[model samples]
Target: MNQNKLQSLMLCLLFYSNVSVYPVTPETIHIIISEDKTMLSEWEIPEELTLDTLESKIGTHDRTNETEDSIKYIWDHLGIVAKFSKNSKFLNKLTVFYATTLKNEEPKQNFKGKMNFFSSDPNQKVEATYKGWICRFKLGNRSLYGICKGENRNLEQIDILSK
Candidate 1:
């Protein structure tokens, strides 16, 4: 694909709420990751989104693609890392990472947190922290805590993975 078209597809993958990842929810987009496919997280894309709009909203950053099939976008200050696979006229196979500190840790955090399951407690809240990411959700009185690392290094040219 051309440069303009590539950028457009990246924007669509990063900020399209109508797009579904797992076909479970129409409004919420969820992604699963990990060696065993045990981690999952929710993401929200902007309603009015475009390449220019994303840059303005998240500020300038770096983009790297060693080949036509894959690309990675990084916004260090904004704590965002996005990876995409290009197969169709429009790119898909999207993965996004937003950097965040876990609880009281200092900023610029990078670590994969552990997943915890707790029994239902009506008066208590669920809590979890992984690496630098934290996920807290409630199902009735049950609580789930999950975390996944979302940072990546840019690949050099001639890399097989990018190829």
Candidate 2:
């Protein structure tokens, strides 16, 4: 091919590749587990905001009326799942699994993260923040939280909530 024609074809191919590689945004849900491993809670946010906005909202109290009993019930159910083979040792190794779905109909992508529970008293409060689609979880104590971030099917970061 002539130089000009070859360059034109390369540019067109590059443009198509770039556009086809657009990242997919999915609804993100943050799961929080109690220190005692007796409770599990979750909150979901739409996938339109930026990560900064989600971070700013962290620790903002938005009560969900989730009682200890409900959390316990869910924990029991989760324990029976074969994938959670270490459920018996949950207290020492608190875990939070992040999940996402496209349009509420597609199969979910599960991303696991570690969490440290400080207290499990029913009076203790829980909070979360959403930056874009990234979500963070915080328990009653200021020191405990988990960060969940990813694009559609992958989890890039899952760090403990510090400082």
Query: Runs in model 2 with CA error above 4 Å?
Result: 1-32, 35-118, 142-163
lDDT of 2 by residue, 4-50 (tens): 99999999999866544321112222344453332222333322323
lDDT of 1 by residue, 78-155 (tens): 233444455433222222323354322212332232222333345554343343544444434333343444453221
RMSD of each: 15.4, 17.4
Give lDDT per model, in order.
0.35, 0.34
**In terms of TM-score, which candidate is strongest?**
1
- Collision count for each candidate, in order: 5, 6
True-structure RMSD for candidate 2:
17.4
TM-scores across all candidates?
A: 0.29, 0.23
